[model samples]
Target: MAQLGIIGHKGRMGQALQQAIADAGHAIAGGVDAGDDAAQLADNCDVLIDFSAPAALEGNLHAAVGAGVPLVIGTTGLTQAHHTAIDNAARVVPILQTGNTSLGVTLLAHLVREAATRLGPDWDIEIVEMHHRMKVDAPSGTAILLGEAAAEGRGIELAAHRESGRDGHTGAREKGAIGFAALRGGTVAGDHSVIFAGNEERITLSHLAENRMIFANGAVKAAAWLIGKQPGRYTMAQVLGL
Candidate 1:
């Protein structure tokens, strides 16, 4: 059994990860909250799982690399600079960064990619996501993951085709555009839907999260899977054998 260290140890996902580790027949070496020293925890554990805010990713990455530990990053709302930093760090330590860490969501992304490939640009693509009010990010990271899947199936870059939100006076829908909408309220764990609309028919794919444990369990499984890998960036699809 590997020893897992949790960043953001007192948060909801961190607590869930604790249970997941035990369920997976592993042990928690210890945990570090916002002001704690991640390097110390990394030195003690075989791997690290981070579910903290975007602001904490850099420090966590440094800590993991300094102690030569694999890391699983579940934090969302990361920017391009953060991605570049991750890319750099992955060269020194195995790292897996993903939006939603649910096995179902990984499979859903596969299906969405396939469907988008068969369908032509005549079909309009729209992604809708809803999360709990406490979630700080808009459009949800899962929404972006699904969008990337669809774009990849279409053989196009997501950055060029993404349409995040439309305001007043926005004209008709742009052909070949991928649109996104986000809703937040109540205590919903998470909900995501991707719609493909054609002239007369429409196709929709979705996944609903009933609780936080789905993500926690997936993260734990990924952490275990990453233990012996080479230093590099990894995806949940890789962990799930997709």
Candidate 2:
């Protein structure tokens, strides 16, 4: 069994993760939340799992590296600086990061990419996602990742033609543009669907997360998998053998 330290111990995801680890027969060495110091927690565990906010990511990575414990990061909203920090940390300890930890969602992303590539530019791609009202970010990190997969499939840059919600007096959808839509209400775990519309038919690929436990389970699995990996960066796709 893997000895795990969970960051964001007070949050919903953190609590879920703790339960999932226990149910899987693993032991939690310690947990650190909002005001707790992550570096101290890292010292007591073989692996650190982060389900915290973007603000805490850098500190958690620093702590993981300092303690020589591999890390599994599920925090989203990462910026360029965070990416840089992750790269630096990977030089010292293994790290696995993913916007959505659900194994089904990762597989859905792969299929979306393949469909986008085979369908050609004639098909218009659009991504729609919905999450709980408490979600802080628009177009959630998972949506952006799905968009990136579609862009890669079409051999186009994601930044070049990304479009979000519009108001009045908008023009027709531009060629090669990928549209994104977000909806928040109730306590929906997550729902993402990619629509590919062409002149003849349409293809819709979707993934619905019914419970938060899927993510929690995936994170624990990732932490266990990172136990002996060499110093480097990894993704959920790699973890799931995609």
Candidate 3:
């Protein structure tokens, strides 16, 4: 069994992870809060799971690299530079960074990719996501993940094809742009839907997160699998054997 260390010990996700660790028969090495030193915790654990904010990512990644431990990062709303930092850190330690880690979402991404590939860009992809009112990020990380899958299937980069905003006087939808819409409010754990709109027809693929436990369970499983892995980036797909 792996010894796991949490980066955000006092948060909602952190509490969920603690329960998941117990369910998975893993031990909690320790944890760190906002002002606490993460590298110290990393030194005592076999793997680190970070479900903290974007502001904490750099230090957390550095801590994992310093201790030569694998890390699973589920924090969302990260920028390209943040990803670059993660890519660099993965050279020293195994790292898995995903917007969402639930098994169902992972499978949904796979299906979305295949459908986008077979249906052609003529279908016009769009992603919509909803989260709890307390969630700070728009378009939810799961939506972005699904959008990336669609972009990958189309053999294009997601950044180049993104259409995140449509407002007053917005003419018409771009031919190949991937649109995104986000909804906030209520106690929703998470919800994502990917729509492929074509002439006289539409195809939609969706996944709903009923509770926070699903993500916690997925993160725990990923932490377990990451132990003894080579220094590189990983994904939920790899953990789920998808």
Candidate 4:
């Protein structure tokens, strides 16, 4: 069995991952929280899984590279600079980064892409997502992931054609734009729905997360798949062979 290490051992996801690691029959090399020595933990593990805050990403990446171990990053709310860092680190070690690690979400993304391609530009795409009240980021990363899939299928750039946080006095919806809406309340793990509206018809795709274990299990599976690989970036789709 592979020995795994966790970068964020105090959070909800981290706790779930601990159980998942055991369920998968993998050994826990160690775990590190905010002030812990991440480099030391990385050096002792066969693979590193990070569900930590975005602010701690650089140090985690450095630790993974320094130890020559593969890493799986499931942390959300990352910016462009963080992505650039991941890309740089990926050149030296195998790295898998994703907004949501659930296998169901990965399949959902594939279906969204297919539907968007067949529907064409006549259909307006809108994504809605809801999460637990404690979630800090708006629009949820999974919503953005679905939006990116739709944009890819339609051969458009999500950055240029994205819309969100619409309040009063918002003009008409732009053609070929992907819109997003976020809801936060109660203890919802996650809920995502993508609506494609067209003349006299509409199509919707959705996925609901009941708890944190789905993500944890998927992350463990992805981490296992990441071991013994050449230096490169990877994805949940690759793990599922989608």
Query: Tens digit of lDDT per residue, candidate 1, span 1-242?
Result: 99999999899999999999999999999999988879999999999999998888989999999999999999999999999999999999999999989999999999999999999788999999999999888889999999999999999999999998788999988889999999999999999999999999999999999999999999999999999999999999998788
Task: Please give, for residues 1-242, the per-residue lDDT of candidate 3 as tens digits.
Answer: 88999989789999999999999999999988897889999999999999988999999999999999999999999999999999999999999999998989999999999999999988999899899999998888899999999999999999888998688998988899999999999999999999999999999999989999999999999899998899999999988787
* Poorest stretch of ten by lDDT in candidate 3: 165-174
Please give the TM-score that candidate 3 achieves against the real structure.
0.98
Evaluated at residue 73, the lDDT of candidate 2 is 89
| Candidate 2 residue-wise lDDT, 137-164, digit = tens | 9898889889989999998889898999
Instruction: For residue 232, give model 4's deviation from the true position in Å.
Output: 0.8
Over all chains combined, what TM-score does candidate 1 have? 0.98
lDDT of 4 by residue, 6-102 (tens): 9998899999999999999999999999977799999999999999999999999999999999999999999999999999999999999999999
What candidate 4 gets wrong by more than 4 Å, as runs, is none
Better of 2 and 3 by lDDT: 3
Better of 1 and 2 by lDDT: 1
Give lDDT per model, in order: 0.95, 0.92, 0.93, 0.95
Give RMSD (Å) of candidate 1 vs. truth: 0.8
| lDDT, model 3, position 70 | 95
